[model samples]
Target chain A: MFELQAPLIARREVASGMWVLSFSAPEVAATARAGQFVNLLLRPGPLLRRPFSVYRATSGVVEVLLKPVGAGTAGLAALALGESVSLLGPLGSGFQLDQAAGSVALVSGGLGVAPMPLAARAAAALGLQVHWVHGARTAAELCSEWEGRRVHWATDDGSIGYHGSVLAAIPEGIGQVVACGPNRMLAALAARFPRAQVAIETYMGCGTGVCLGCAVPRTSGVYDRACKEGPVYQANDIRWDVLPQHLHYGLGA
Target chain B: MSGLRVGGVELRSPVLAASGTFGYGTEVPLCDRPRLGGMVSKGIFLQPRPGTPPPRIVETPSGMLNAIGLQGPGVEALIRDYCPLWAEWDFPVLVNINGESVDEYAELAARLDGVPGVSGLEINISCPNVREGGMFFGKDPAQAAAVTAAVRRSTRLPVWVKLTPAVSDLAEVARACESAGADALCAINTLVGMSFDLGTGRPRLAFGTGGLSGPAIRPIAVHLAHQAAQSVAIPVIGIGGIGGAEDALEFLYAGCQAVQIGTATFIDPNAIGKTMEALEALDWRRLVEGTRAAISSG
Candidate 1:
């Protein structure tokens, strides 16, 4: 909930158009959880703040992964070393993992892998066996592997591990599943598994939950704000059918 | 720093956080809640509104377009859940009221009358009047006057009518509200606008059209504030795209009694606090002497 001018500590391109940025935000790094996000203020012209999931946090530093999809993110990607950026976070409810579960699965598609690295580290700390399943259009888009963890990959063009959707690569007998990505992939995951927690992506204003702009329909017939009630929700709690068709794919980040 | 007296309430500073941007002023940590002049809460309605579906907001150059549809928890929930918290804060809290009809506006004012922790009312006439075939109350001076008069009669609290920038004659509407017993005038609300997605060949926002706010609208807002201040006898609270002390000075030089910080809060959560700091650093003595010299030279 604190706003700070965090100086860029490190910036590296992990994929073709994707990057990982680390910032020196001690307070946010200290308090941020696995599923929460940070809203980065872009250049003045585009007034809307861009929200990015917390990729990693350790010892007075926090990292966020982003792809240059539009003007807001492109502005972020263009920042130089030692530049100070305005950051408002750590925001929204992140993935809630069950401590009692013996085994867990982390499913990610496309840029959805932004939040999984931290989730993988957290699940390992909780004494649960973690499995990572990742998918993209090609092998170059797949994120680099997490050290000392079992990782599975899927590519649509048959250039990687499995020649199908990442949903097909997930093994059975997983006690719990956590996912993040485009809505269509999330919908498929929700339909296939009953015990799944998903982090949703939507258009938001004032990421602090005051504007009520980021709304997702719930199974209970009420719209819940994705900023406050969650960017993360239990799979069955969402009413996916009522969501707009354009939102089903890769539009929102 | 000197304070501002609007209607019956006295504020610590003249820079207040605008409605819909600052939330309840509870979660903002760096904002220095007690030092703020005042804060307007989010728009409240007779019943809870679900608001428009996603994409409710979109970026448009130096501004943003949003059609949040005034989503709120209704009047009863505000009284039950948030008023107790407001009562604890040292600063005054003005409730922004929105309604579907003249009667609904009056009823909402009546319900808030004499309520503890409630400092005043700022009527949001920008919403569509369901009884009038979806025409907005603020768009027409006569309808705006009627709504203001109804609320003025219903409550003893100080009333400030929030006017829209989309109207043709903003001064006419300002005068109309002043004639109907409004204590002050808050000028101006967001300009009605829209944006389209080029790739998808559709409107960027789900509602198709929305209200635009930010630095892009500042010059237009200053022009309207100047007009409204000239036309009305009541104090004018200037709003729309105020980011820093310089922007606020434009409204003050234009004759506004106070200014409200809106879209800037989205950029920095402590924008109000920062603006207050910047204002305190200014030499008022020099500014007054300069103004006097200019007037004499002319």
Candidate 2:
């Protein structure tokens, strides 16, 4: 993992408070995979670095999606075009997609959409058809910026494409499920599809396992660092009953 | 000239990675290796610990609270897995040993004794998150001395007692450890603190309370390190909220011979290296003498 100041190349508010920020981090972008994340050091804001999923990486630039639910995300959302922030990443394990045969479903909920676009692109490059299923509380909160093929939108208020949760909108024949979202949704996904890969959410520190702060409990009664051992894990391996649902983002109210 | 000795272990720089913050000294590769004086591995017990549950950490203004409860692999695993890696590294690696009893502390020291790549032991007697034995011995001078003395008798390696700022008389505990044959003293573990989640009407940390670290605790760390330095002849390795060279100087000016970088690493993985780089620009002898003069004058 490399730690360096990457200049902000682009910033866009894809949704009301949701932002897609791109930085000129060639090293991290070069090595960044589908589920890996970048830890942005938000100085003049919070004391700890906030982890963001790699929304997309192209050429020499890396992008991360942010929903301004807290002071740290708000500060990152307010960064001007020319500003540079300290970026430490390409950290944590990413989605393992090489083994899938026919098709792959990239599922996301709310800000969980951050990593879906990248996962979609990666699966497409592997000659596999990709299905992107996204959901938000309302259509206003939906970030449908992805240009991937077969994008399906789900909303809780019956104001969008599928008038139900993202899980309800998944195509019956969709293959190899990969998801990133809140604990409850992931837990449900784990129940239905035990082999699904999930990117979890946890309050993190150090983003490197050193702090042991981001403990994601396993079904074996063992805890793993969400930053190091994961951010990505097979759904069935997690002990969902013990997971706390305190975070605001991902499949909002 | 930047190299120095702390409790008999030769540190290339005066900045060491504090225990718990640096893990087993195996996780962070971005940390500048050449600039690191040494590293104190995470605190370990006799057996593997599951540590506290989720929401173990919460960020506060200018600091963060964590109650990881000294989660770590047991000593046997450390000697087998981590020590070999340390033996290959170019710096000293001190194991931060914890115990639920004085005998347990002594046994941990004995287990690490003569182990390859193990330079010394930092007795963790001030972990507030644990239910027993951690800060229990640290708060009292007699118990502090007793644990220190037992560990001293168990191992031939240098022993540094990490002090807790939660105590009423930090100096008394420092003197007691020195009298019990501590090779050095590491002043100021995290200060006990808690934060509440207004929505849930409950504490932010699952452990209810945690040890606060980062810039929020720097001033208190300098003060306590100074008090410990004044009370004991043994070296004082300053810790808590040391983010940059200026902060490390506060500890040195307060009479600390060296400093350890903790919570700052979370903000910047290269904090220790950056601090070491900044310190390299200063006169090392003057800094040491400055600390000595500061302690002697008071």
Candidate 3:
């Protein structure tokens, strides 16, 4: 395991507060696993490493989604194509895709919808029937739409699809559910589903396996480091309430 | 505060930011760089280290843990990409060099030979050194001394040795680094700590049991810094549990020549800047209080 600072090989403002940062790392891309994350060692001068999900992985590049919410993201968003930055990755454990998730419902909030496009693509390749749900505080926050999948969007203000949350919109018949988002949002969904797969967030350090810093309580009675044990976790496995009183990414609201 | 010389350069303050936490100085916002006594950069190895598996970091209350595994482009890559940047900056940039072997250490030191932007060297003996039977050279005085001696022989740059607190006798290692012609010392690297997931009942880290950091490890850092400072003649740069200026002062009172902010940067990049501001405020308060007392007595 290692941590690296990759430069911005290409970046473009895709939306109001969001941009696509393409960093340099070949080994990371070659071994890129679905649902894995890399701690983008951004403006440590301005801020420390910021974790970003590997949105999509190619043979030589890993695409990460960035929302210019803070100093690090803001600096990252301003990078011109080919401007170098540091990226230490591909860090953390990722999703354990179950071809057994025959009929599944995937849920996320705003940019958290990241790991999905590839996940849906992966499940489709596995021939698993999939249904997807996306959430945002507003319609302006939503990113891409899955082409052939049944996509649902929920906005807190009712700007998009559902009025409440994905948990409320969750159709009752699905056997397995997968999700990612704010701790509260994830917490609510975990509280609701209580048996779905989930992902958690935290500020990061080494992005490798040496720092036992992140924590995720498991339902079966265990605390796991979100960095190493998961960015992806089985929903039923987490001890939902043990999350930090103040979660990362200013997502608590 | 006076004898702040390490190797060849003299520093104004005994505190220096530790490597891996502060990138080559420039990584910090420019406004705060001036207050830092010095900056030890992310670990530079012989070859670029494409660090370990993902989820490299996890934040805990008052601190953060990281398993960056000393990720950086090789020293050459650093010189090509990061050094010139460091040269232009006003704050001193001390490069922390890491390797799996003694020769690698010496070789890299030699390669760094005349790089202009580079200031001094931090021997990251916290890692394994070759010719030491795969044992972490930092854990043993003999290996530590041998590795220090080798690197000392290789470079004229200010060489400061970084020690890990996980070892049994830190004093022995301190003395070893001193004997090996080291200039100054960075005390207490990350303490070996880990957590596990009880659900799957598996190890938490893919590498299992990563380093524990942040406020949780502060007291231990202070204890080690004091002990190392007492044991060595060289200046001590204390790192660990340093989330703020008071924590940095705690190290200073314990006798550290300089201090580093590690996990603090994860949560607040301005930790060093804030701490410096806090210290100055305290300094101003002390100055005023002392003046008032003198005037009253007179």
DockQ, per model, reads 0.52, 0.58, 0.09
Label model 2 with its docking quality class: medium
Candidates sorted by TM-score, best first: 2, 1, 3
Docking class of 1: medium
Per-candidate local distance difference test: 0.83, 0.88, 0.69
lDDT of 1 by residue, B1-298 (tens): 5456885567778889888887776656667665588999988888987777677777777787788777778999999888888888878899999887899999999999988888999899864312221238898999889999999999999998888887888989999999999999988888878777776878878888888889889999999999999998899999989998889888877778888998888777778888877777885435635765787699
Interface RMSD of 1: 3.8
lDDT (Cα, 0-100) at B61 in candidate 2: 78
Taking the true A–B contacts (Cα pairs closer than 8 Å), what share appears in each candidate?
0.54, 0.78, 0.14
Q: Listing candidates in order, what is each one's chain A TM-score?
A: 0.95, 0.95, 0.87
lDDT per residue as tens, model 1, A58-87: 999989998877767777788878887888
Cα error, residue B95 of model 1, in Å, equals 0.8
Superposed on all Cα atoms, the candidates' RMSDs to the truth, in angstroms, are: 2.5, 2.4, 13.6
lDDT of 3: 0.69
- List, residue by residue over B1-298, the lDDT tens digit for candidate 2: 4458878889888999999889888788889888999999999999999999888888887888899988887989998999998999889999999999999999999999999999999999999999999998999999999999999999999999999998888999999999999999998899999888877788888899999998899889889999998898999999989999989988988888789999988878889999989887876568768667776898
Candidate 3: misplaced stretches above 4 Å?
A1-253, B1-7, B12-14, B60-62, B127-135, B284-298
Tens digit of per-residue lDDT, candidate 3, span A169-214: 7777886787888777887786677777777776455444323345
Give the range of the ten consecutive residues with the poorest summed lDDT in model 3 chain B: B126-135
